[model samples]
Target: MAAGAAPVTTESDCRCDVMAVTDRDCAGVTACPGDRGLLLVAPGGYRGRVRDPNLTRSAAGQLSPERRATDLRRLRTERFDVLIIGGGVTGAGAALDAASRGLKVALVEARDYAAGTSSRSSKLIHGGLRYLEQLEFHLVHEALTERGLLATRLAPHLVRPVPILVPLPAGESLRDLPARAFRRAYYGAGVATYDAFAGVFGGGRGMPLHRHLSREGARRIFPSLRADALAGAIRYYDGQVDDARLVVTLARTAASLGATVVTSTRAVGLIRQAREVTGVRVRDLEAAPGSPDAEFEVHARVVIGATGVWSDDMSRMLNDVGLRPGIRVRASKGVHLVVPRSAITGETGLILRTASSVLFVIPWGGHWIIGTTDTDWRLDRSHPAASARDIQYLLDQVNTVLDRPLTTADIEGVYAGLRPLLAGEADSTSKLSREHAVFEPMLGLLLVAGGKYTTYRVMASDVVDRAARRLGGVRPSRTADLPLLGADGYAAMWRDRADLARRHGVPVGVVEHLLERYGTLTRELLALIDADPLQASPLAGAPEYLAAEVTYAARAEGALHLEDVLTRRTRISFETTHRGLESAGHTAELMGAVLGWDAATREREVAHYRARVEAERESQLMPDDATADAARLGAPDVRGFAADRGVDGDSVELPTSSR
Candidate 1:
């Protein structure tokens, strides 16, 4: 398990005796029974052998502190073929695409991975059904194709099929029957076309086709729907994912393929020579104050600006150096509200039309995520605040069809994200296109902006295709055929869920949850549970996640701060009614042990997290964007604090030593 060491596995290393059932019949007490017994395949079927519990301890895929340091050293010393700015899904995907195609790649994120628009997405991996109404068949086809690939071939563990119900307004009387019929025909044709596109591009993979339901059937499926709200409903299948996890997984997958993925790093300036972009000037946001290497430069043959909403700022940086800008990005803010499952009794998700954008009542694990309002935002790009007006707007729209309206008290979490809409003459943000455009604004520089989360893979493929032309002899994108880290052997692992539960001495539900989140990578967590059974216990306040997950975030997921573990690594921050406050202390302590934080550092981490929750609460009470942004700024950024405080005795210094 040493750094760069190959995992040792043999044909006789099968551990089938650990579990007595297959994933199908195990009910949750068995392990996967592969052809060669209970031997699990490592990611990408590397070596085609059973994975050693210790193999994950190596430098290959483990995003440990040691790996981070190693990657940082490489970023400073080595010249890469492509250096990507931004660590959201698009950037991460681009890095994976470039690295897999045999290009030397390095990726830097100003904040944590998916800490921007990527994680704040609606969490759907479907073709934009509304786009069909806009007559955007090409966009729909591309998105559907990528959705199919994600659910079937790529990140199967993180992406799965979800059914959505669209309710039709009820008629006033028998005399209004013709109008109702017309409404049904109109909506029904649109849905039928959606299914047709999926059939053609989705490869007929995952989830059932669309189906029409009577009022009784709709009510039966969603008893909480208002009796007068709908005469009938349409049910269709789409895919959903843990958006944050997908971004992190993409980074990890790229790292495993030899790309340098560094978080807590900011790209401050573009390094140019003559008229060609050469590299990037980056600052380690986590570095101690006045540290010599805190701000350094990385050399690369080409640099890509994949920053989402900050795309314009990146373009401005090039303009500052006299490079002509080829693209402009308009920022649109979308906010979502998370409430407990008791708020709405629905077996399937609900999608409703609004004045501008569509609103979705998605069924999360133990909550319903209802959102969002699309409005132009000219406030803070880092933390877009969800104002009281934004929350009220959502509540009003969703309340129109719900039997029991939700109040502010029912809201567990509120989040706002800014979309990088490609700037056009369109007056409204909702009218902007989701289609992306890639441009080489300058020699050796590629800029990609404006694409939906569902079509990220396509966007990545397209950007890399353009980059590949500049770097001659580079291979074409192979990501279409490359399954993400946890995707390999997922079908077999699912079958052995029961056996895995039994092997780990946990409930079937816990195993199932782990399987969905980590896929075949669940074994790494199982190893932690085996080493210390205490790790298998549910989190102190949030029972939805295991305590080991918090530790794993630090040990293997490159989590450098408490917020990264609580908010992005797991959904504890938003899923819990306490907004992760009650669990903050315990979660920080767990991460502290793995990241080598002292007692003061641990306490500081907890304090900062509490302040963040409070700031969000205060922001939610504000009436407008300006006031909300001001309120949100009341909580100082933890990384910013680190940078400002430097290595002074008053502040706890971030540990530079490897864990």
Candidate 2:
């Protein structure tokens, strides 16, 4: 194969026979070679034509208001084979996995999808290099494999390769030369092992191999590095993603595969008959403030909990039935600070070793992300506030090698997320395992927790495999070859970006921005802009975002609240210095037009969003988690739904007419 050329596969290159035989043994299907793998057989065992993966393109996958309403109705009326709690990446992946395998699946989330840890990650789909030092080869391999898949086959639109530079300090003394050489050798060996694993297991290959650079070479690549701070640097590739977008894409993909995805609905308790768990009792948190809560039941053959940090809460709900969950979740909070890209002036991302955890100075669009502090957190899971101490710690660590130090004034945004590390004998949160564990505490109940973001698909597949044993006749997970909603024709769309920009009468940069965010779906956004040319203009306050995106968030994405659109969907909230307050009203107006919100309701949404931003600011100023949690909780939740930390029994019922 030539450089950058697509590979051609012939009949001999097909692994269908091997995959079909393996799937048959796992799924207990005795059908012959005719009825296996991607090739579907007729009723009489005659081999049918091969199915075209790209044949279907339906707007049914779009999470518009109509779809949400229809899905909610389906949730209340239908019984599914699998009921997945939490619409985070793991649950979304599980829904996709189960649904793609020809099983009925439904996923319900308490808040907006990816509102938790999924959206707040460092945005890297890296094979854990630190894990290799910990002798966790399996984890590194699994994460690398998933990373390759995301960057190439699965979500090429969302995931891309990011080159990182690890600096090595210059040796001044003659005595220090051997020590420096040893350090370099040690780091090089580890990185080589990392690359080897990626090469062997990574299915979709795109990234370049690791390279050693001289100090001058390193400085040439990253001129911002402080002089005399490094002897040289090692460059390596890892995958990066729009974490929140990946979650929503997963949910949308799952929805496209016939899974009913409902957000803004809380799972109050497990519906149990005698000793076996069967379904969930849920409450619509979108109920009018001061109105009675409307509750309903979603029955399923099996319930899978993928609620990340809130796993313990879900487990506690099952405890009421006298079924004690063996796995316990220990929450660890990780915080990241975002500054403008001009602050660093680096071509590649920097990976600096910190005393406690690794610091990543990642390059985002027009901004750089510097993070993170890993500490045990027992505060409110919903809002894990980052304190001044945490901010100072990150700044102090990153400043060690920066030519220009970043202060609080330089920060554009700050976000905090809690990792659901499964409790083990490890003393520190950093020492805890990233490997996930699945448990069946009851007959129809399943719980999956602990894994890192990179291995969510694997975790999802494992959980569904367990569920398949319970619900017989369900095929194995087919998500390995599945492309996310916007991934199928992304490469082609990217190649024709210039033409798209010319056709749409927008700048090439604008088209490129849309492509990076929406991939091939950029065409749909362009269509919206074409219908109303004004929609092509930048937002009133947040010029980085187009007005059309705000409307699209509500119309096509499942953004019920203004905060959802600003904060997660477009990232305007944290990306702006005003924390999206300036654009709040205008954005809300766009959303209101789609959601049919009255003027009063639009005003209220804007007010609520500003209050939320103020609360977040106040929380960041607090000294500790306790005070921060109190400050954050001071802001009213959009739907007035309080955290049901220890609630028991069925959800409180409101009038059915409230629906």
Candidate 3:
């Protein structure tokens, strides 16, 4: 390994020529990569051609289709020091950590990156405040430390502080005065302790201290709050992010550090040499079942499973390979609904304590995210369905404080994700502690599961540290201080955003949006637009996203299907009033151009996405989890294998029933 030189991806083979951002440091900064004419890089850098038509130059962290193809070849032939399954936050983090430590690492995901629980989180990066009530001080402290790191250092561009209010309800009469005083004292003390923990841990909270406001003051800040709802409110700050975007950034960061990151690839069976795991037999979900290239074995010194709820399924794979699983994971469903920001006339987000758990009303761009219910889920883990009852429960809970009650018509989007809680004896899923566990049941396999999103980097560090112990001579983790792909020199980039917008002939507001979504990587999109100025035009249906963004997702963000682009890469699926139906065809077209899809393939992609939206709508109408799950399954998966792994097909099918 050499300083300022790209890490070679595979052993004894120059499969890819991954050039670091720039050959020379520019004015002692990483943001300006030498006039920004990137040389596209990949596993097999390039074929016989001087330049690739699809990809322009060698850019570190770009997961172009060519890179995936080359990486797949490497996965089938090369040996790695560490192999990580699951492309969620933790798995991606692990890959980055291991790769930066100078180890050969490969990561495979069953679906798109952040396709499961990682993308559907409440979008908050905070130490669990309620955990303080549970006397889980260590957990809170650890999580707070990580939060500070993400907000201030690790991913300052992506993670930002958001103000939240805890409304103090007014008493009905003098008889209830004691309850009011008690509520204020208890909550105030808990919040003060939370601040103290943050102040003592890491560097600091990285946001303003909590503030107590009078009833009139709170009402003035939140005009839509019912006059009789609260006596006052306590406002504090927590970090928030586009969860799916964060995961994508992590994967890109891992790739930039020489980790082989692939999605739409699943672990089907464990490759074992009698009681010891040697590698994994993986199924390329993108490949047709039973095809010659459908499945391949990836060899590694140590194998780790970071699958969340899918942790139990890894146990099944172990059973097939004559190994017993050591980790037990329970799935808890969390549902969130998105509505226009105008639905709630509030300047700050709200946190409400419910009978069983806490609920958050988070402020998204031009939208409000209200959620979530904590209940055990036994149905489909891949597509956890949110039922009508669940939606009603959230509405009822939030309506207690809002001047105007919300209805189904107010919802623009709904999503449900499963939380992997470490199996415990607690009767309710809400009672289960948000703690993670790691296991090495077999000689070469490591299993890490069950933790809150806030501590993903910590979890990644722990799992990799264990794996390093098995593979001697590995270096310590370097992720705590290391920034993600777009993090370094972000402040300078943001400071010159106006000049950047002017140089690119784009609006300052547009530049601001790109900076928030992509820090220094915004240059990539600007480059794409420069190549084809037409791509600068916003989508007809979803004006918030430029056409270039869709192409960028396909070319550099590892988006294989239409749903991946709509739902995760850009979030147009949930942000739009039509739930992305109005934008599906155009999105597919833009993605098709990069993915090399013909007319028929593009049509199929559009059809599949539309059917998925409808199925989600129908499922939301269902009264119970079972019915909702069944309704949601009516739409076949864009990745055929995601619907049912046993299904025999290579095509991302669009059935007439769903259409």
What Cα-based lDDT does every candidate model obtain? Answer: 0.81, 0.80, 0.82
TM-score of predicted structure 3: 0.90
Against the hidden true structure, what lDDT does model 3 obtain?
0.82
How far residue 400's Cα lies from its native spot in candidate 2, in Å, is 0.8
Please, what are the lDDT tens digits per residue for candidate 2 over residues 94-168? 988887776678888888888889889999999989899899999999999999889999889899999999899
Write down the RMSD of candidate 1 (Cα, Å). 8.4
**lDDT-better candidate, 1 vs 3:** 3
Residue 332 of model 1, lDDT score: 92
Better of 1 and 2 by TM-score: 2
Q: Give a tens-digit lDDT track for model 3, residues 1-659.
A: 22243433332333222222222322221111111122222232230111122232226678999989988998998898899988888888888888777677899887889988899999999998999989998899999999999988889989999999999999999998899889888889988888888888956568789988889998888888888999888998899999999999988887765678888887777788978999988878788667999888999999988888877666655565565767788889999999999899989999998999999999999999999999999887778899999999999999999999999899999999989899989999999978888898788988899889989998999999999898876667778777777777789999999999999999999999998998888998999888999989998689988998999999999999999988999888888779899988898889888888999999999889889999999999999999999999989888775454322353221110100
TM-score of model 1 vs. true structure: 0.89
The candidate maximizing lDDT is 3
The deviation in Å at residue 446 for candidate 3 is 0.5
Worst 10 residues of 3 by lDDT: 650-659
Name the runs in model 2 displaced over 4 angstroms. 1-58, 288-293, 648-659
Ranking by lDDT: 3, 1, 2
Model 2 lDDT, residue 487, Cα = 83
